[model samples]
Target: MSEMYKKEVPLYGDLIDLVSDVNTETLAQQPEIRQQLEHSGELTRLNMERHGAIRLGTAAELSMMRRLFAVMGMHPVGYYDLAPAGVPVHSTAFRAIETESLNRSPFRVFTSLLRLDLIADEQLRQEARAALDQRQIFTDNVIDLIERFEQQGGLTKDESQQFVKEALETFRWHDNTPVSKTLYQSLLAQHGLIADVVGFKGPHINHLTPRTLDIDTVQARMQGKGIAPKAIIEGPPKRDCPILLRQTSFKALEEAVSFQNAEGGYDTGHHSARFGEIEQRGVALTPKGRALYDKLLNQAREQLGGTPNEHNAAKYYQLLDSAFEAFPDDYQTLHDEGLAYFYYRAVDDGVDMSTAISDLDTSASQTETAKQAIADLIEQGAVRIDPIVYEDFLPVSAAGIFQSNLHDEKQSDYQGPSNQQEFEQALGAAVYDELALYQRLQSQSLELCLLALDSKA
Candidate 1:
């Protein structure tokens, strides 16, 4: 890491201030919300291409990333270990939040720091590890500044100007310094965006996941094309409510590449590691509701015996839907239930809902009114269920994918016991005590996916 990059760049937390500090609440309610989302997505794609390598390497690049992302109101959230599957990988996933939802939940970026040791030569690997060990990734000043800015939200005019300037600089690459090919290779892999980062010169987009209303259909269509996925998109099986998220990735297509060797010569060949990813998402359910949803999925699965496939996805969804058709508690009745998680106020005026119920078309007795309403809302845009982000690669699923793709899965032995508690404490996150949360996320996510399938009985 160079001193110029170090002393000059602002951290991500500070950049978050620059974004959140803007008086943008009014803008969120308008169509601007969608525009902002599109803008943010575009920016992310750009970063994945432009700063693909160094963003994960030196302290400077890491700090710069924080600043750059903060400008878009994105924050770091969960730590996902893609390595549990045993492939050469290191990455974390995040949900980038828009300006409006800051109070509702943390908008996150699933930033990943790839491990260089996996690819470097023995001597280079030792040095890289040692550098990583000694390096201070985040300064106390940076953390303090972020915390203060978060609490205060907006700064004075002068501070805002300075913040914006500093934030932009974080993404700026180091002054075209010539680095060893090996070091550059390590830096490239650090972002974990695409396979080309690992010494290949050919660059391509990894996956551009769309939030679909019909994941089951999409999955079926793709699979029918003989596109075997990296894994079963996770979350729950299709159910009454939309599950949180589902994801699938197609295999990478080969692309031409050239690598510079240790002898300062070029080696040319073709490499492939970039693939298209797609996702479907549903409403973010409450934790308790998520639990019951999980149980319902297990119940549905048990009833179905052993096999699960796309054809039976809707059948299983209907089973869960029938079981939990009504509200769990009485206060919120079917008519009163609007969009599940999203908050909305009636835009139409002079119409008392209860008395004027007959004005709107109602489903017949055989058709459950709530179900019809849900279906209608889904079709008409009142309700929003995102396609599963599929950003998360389950350890088991990742391992499976790696095993399927690799020459061997059993080549390396990991015999050392893991101290999960110590690991959590070190990261300053809460200890994982309950399987309930994980199960619920999975279940609700599945239900959302099921709703997307129109074939539900």
Candidate 2:
């Protein structure tokens, strides 16, 4: 997929190189961070990380997408509603669930289904549906492979390679428009996203993102390397201990396309939809921490009075920093206060048995003593706490990235409702609750650490 994307978008290869250089420099400068990533099994997967985004035109496409990703050991992890953020789609990130699978290859796809109901023009909505219905995104061979995998419970090595080849065609860019230019324009008038979904032959992978240790560095260096990055990065401001996902991207490419004309001929035009993106993930937040994050984010946005852009990005970031000062910055504080999730590991400190036993003596109850012992071990550097990497997307941040890549004037006026139920119905399965996943990971780690501490006692 990376090779296909690099071939299609030449700049993407450059972006990949830039991110690789930045990661190398980051690791050299921050050996502690490198050690943390290596200890957590993240360093190996750092360069292997790639998450692509695609807009689906129908429920069938999304349902089929779920089956397709399953062949690669990817599952839909979380639900994201972009309607509230002004993009007319709800999404789920399809990626590997198991840590081992993730370490092998953490390729994810941010798949979104177009919300046709958001189109205010009744005629345009129907026309868009008609346009979408006439096109098929997946190749016949890929569908056959998906069905075979379902029957056999897996694909053979040869079949797997063939399946990948066939699946790549689905995301490959097609220059020919499925709909006529007039119909494309009509749908474009409704929304640029709508046109991108319904006008094209297929939902080409819009952007392929590479994970970076420092997105600010990449964003700052993009221009020097002849790559134009977006004006502002999306998500939380830079922090000592980053929380959740921070993203930045280069502008979408304007590529030539042939639009069908009424006279049975084609006319040349351009479309801007695909781009290069970079991300830096932080610890997954608990529900309480997420609520606070949302509250502070809303406060900052309300104060700014508009979407973050060049004009107010500095002031917005300042306000965001001030608002988030209330949130804890240290990993220990975040974990202790139950604001964030972390994986706890028992470390052999080589301390004397007498010292370990002496630290356990307390006036508290038996359970309290155990808790205190564990806390003391952590404080005394006998236990290590690693923040669980956030494996989900932020709706607002996703929408912000979408909006920035799209044409500035092409704003949607559709103030419609969000229907997660409808999205699930279309998906043919319920989306996983990301918070629950994080909670389970955190709880399991703590339980293991407690058991280790009990044995020590």
Tens-digit per-residue lDDT, 230-325, candidate 2: 887888889989999999999989999999888888988888889899999998999889998999999998998888887788899899999989
lDDT for every model?
Answer: 0.40, 0.85
138-237 per-residue lDDT for model 1 (tens digits): 4354444455566787456765665555543333332222233455455434322323333322111233333444456555556555565543454455
Collision count for each candidate, in order: 28, 0
Choose the strongest candidate by lDDT. 2
The lowest-lDDT stretch of 10 consecutive residues in candidate 1 is 46-55
In Å, residue 438's CA in model 2 sits off its true spot by 1.2
- Cα lDDT over the full model 2: 0.85
Q: Given candidate 1, what's the lDDT at residue 232? A: 46
